[model samples]
Target: MTDISTSDVQHLAQLSSLQLDDHEVEALRVDLGNILGYIDQLSELNTEGVEPTYQVTDLQNVWRDDVIDNYDLGRDELLALAPDADSNQIKVPKVL
Candidate 1:
């Protein structure tokens, strides 16, 4: 079992640029110790003969055939749909 000292907690706070009070530092020391202990426990588990998994499910590329369909429409026909138009051109409000 590893022990987390108050100084270690303070150093961590300094590294993270955190302003920790006395109570907060004490709480952080205990929390960090518990996290380290859990990680140590995980280190003891046997991982021999185990394949490192990259993905859980079968990876498949889902793709569809690209098809292009052109609609036959004149410039005047498109300009008529706009709310505002100027001399055969559609005009909108200035963005900026």
Candidate 2:
């Protein structure tokens, strides 16, 4: 089993900005130790001949050419649709 000290748990809580009580701190100390022990057990597994798996779904991204379709609307025609327009640009009320 991993040895997780009280100070270690307290330090972790401080780093995470957590306000843990004494009971919660103690509980987390044990849990953290158990997690580390499990990781240690996994480190002992034989994976010398195993291949690393990246994507399990075997799916790939289907990409299409980016074609701009303006629907036959010219710049002036689109600007005319806006409530306000000046200097070939749409104008709106100040947001801030």
Candidate 3:
């Protein structure tokens, strides 16, 4: 079993910028000890030949060939539709 002392709790509180009261320090000492004991128990597990899994879901990438579109309107026809047009291009207001 882990033995978390009052001094250890105080030190941790200082490092974390916490101002713990006497009661809070005592309470955390017991709680931290219990947490460490539980973690120590997990160290007894045996997994000698288990494969490491990165992801649990069975997913694959679905890809398709890229295709270029040829709309009926040419550059000149598109520029005519714009509110303002410059030399073979649409004009927009300048932003800072």
Candidate 4:
């Protein structure tokens, strides 16, 4: 079993930029200890000839040729449809 200390939890929280209260710190210490213990248990397994599995699903990426299509509309014609335009650019209300 792994022994996780209070300082270990505090150091982890500091590195992660998390402001944990005392109660939460205690909770996380136990949780981290349990996780490490489970990992230790897994390390005891023996598999001499087992093949390592990278991905379970036999999925492959499908690719398609890139095609560009414009609906026959000119730049100036599209700009004219906008409610507000200035210097060949559409104007929108300021955000934030």
Evaluated with TM-score, which candidate comes out highest? 4
State which candidate has the highest lDDT.
Answer: 2
TM-score of each: 0.44, 0.45, 0.44, 0.47
Question: Candidate 4's error at 92, in angstroms?
Answer: 22
- Summarize candidate 4's per-residue lDDT along 1-96 as a digit string, tens digits: 589999999999999999999999999999999999888986778978999988878877766568865669889999999999999999999988
Off by over 4 Å in 4: 14-17, 47-51, 60-96
lDDT of 3 at 69: 60
Query: Candidate 2 — worst ten consecutive residues by lDDT sum?
Result: 56-65
Show how many residue pairs clash in every candidate, following the order shown: 0, 0, 0, 0
By TM-score, rank the candidates, best first. 4, 2, 3, 1
- lDDT value, residue 54 of candidate 1: 80
- Candidate 3 residue lDDT tens string, 1-96: 599999999999999999999999999999999999889986788868988788878876756568766557678887899999989878889977
Pull out the clashing pairs in model 3: none
Better of 1 and 2 by TM-score: 2
**Which stretch of 10 consecutive residues in model 4 shows the poorest summed lDDT?**
62-71
Candidate 3 Cα RMSD (Å)? 15.2
Q: Report lDDT (Cα) of residue 79, candidate 1.
A: 86
Report lDDT per candidate. 0.88, 0.93, 0.88, 0.92
Model 2 misplaced stretches (Cα beyond 4 Å) = 45-96
lDDT value, candidate 1, whole model: 0.88
